[model samples]
Target: MTLIRLAIIALCMVFTAGPYAEESANLTDGGISVSDKNFPWQLVVDRGKILGCVYDNKFYSLGAILILESLPRKCELASDRNGIWEQLTEAELLLWQESIEEQQATKQEANYIGNDPINDEEARLIRYLRSAKKRADTQ
Candidate 1:
């Protein structure tokens, strides 16, 4: 009788513990929850390379296609239409874009030479001219 009671208790424990163990395993396997803040953006993988955008709020994947369509002819010409199917999340995309912008700005800054050797007035004028040139170049 005692052995039978022990067996029943063990069975009950296994049944109760099964779900909890499965839930934890699912979480570890990257099963995203809707309420999770990290779920806002995700990379849409296709063939291999990243090709387009996907806004979290959009129901369809047409956001990237529309963006590509809206680009200027010259910009469109530079895009690889065939391989451009993958998408990185907005945050990841922005981070990469910002880095590229920073690199371009740094390269531009490195190309300039100061004409004002000693005079404070000339130095101020040079700084002003450089700032104005940078603004114009960016636009």
Candidate 2:
């Protein structure tokens, strides 16, 4: 009975720890996993070297290499600036930075409608030009 209870408790701990704790040990040695949503992308990592990264479903190798290549450069740049590069060590930072820049540029572009104003003055000018053209055509 005691053995059964202990077994049950162990099973419960394993189940409740979730993926992070269960995966953490393997992850330190680098492991890969697919997203729960089953997206075409897969996450890859090299245990102690890489924290892990998401790659295109079809181009996992290429994506992983790209991430690995860019990481050191980004870290070097961050360290030069005396910023928090050590704590921010992850392949996702590259993707996140690009995403942030893209969003910011998109927001800036969205703020400007166009050079031409669609106000009453512009409308009046357009109407005057149309009337002038009509009168000239009639004459």
Q: What is the TM-score of each candidate against the true structure?
A: 0.23, 0.20
The per-candidate count of clashes, in order, stands at: 0, 3
Q: Tell me the lDDT of candidate 2.
A: 0.36
Per-residue lDDT tens digits for candidate 2, residues 1-139, read 9567444433432332233232333221222344435533324233323233333322222112222323321122122232122222343444344444555554344443364336556666766886899999999
The model with the greatest lDDT is 1
- Report the lDDT of model 1 for residue 117: 35
What's the lDDT for all of these models? 0.37, 0.36
Candidate that would win on TM-score? 1
- Cα lDDT of model 1 by residue, 1-139, tens digit: 9567444433433333332332423211222333456543355334553233223322222122212222211011115432222343454344334444555554345444443234556556767897999999999
Q: How far does residue 37 in candidate 1 sit from its true spot (Å)?
A: 46
* Stretches of candidate 1 exceeding 4 Å from the true structure: 1-84, 114-139
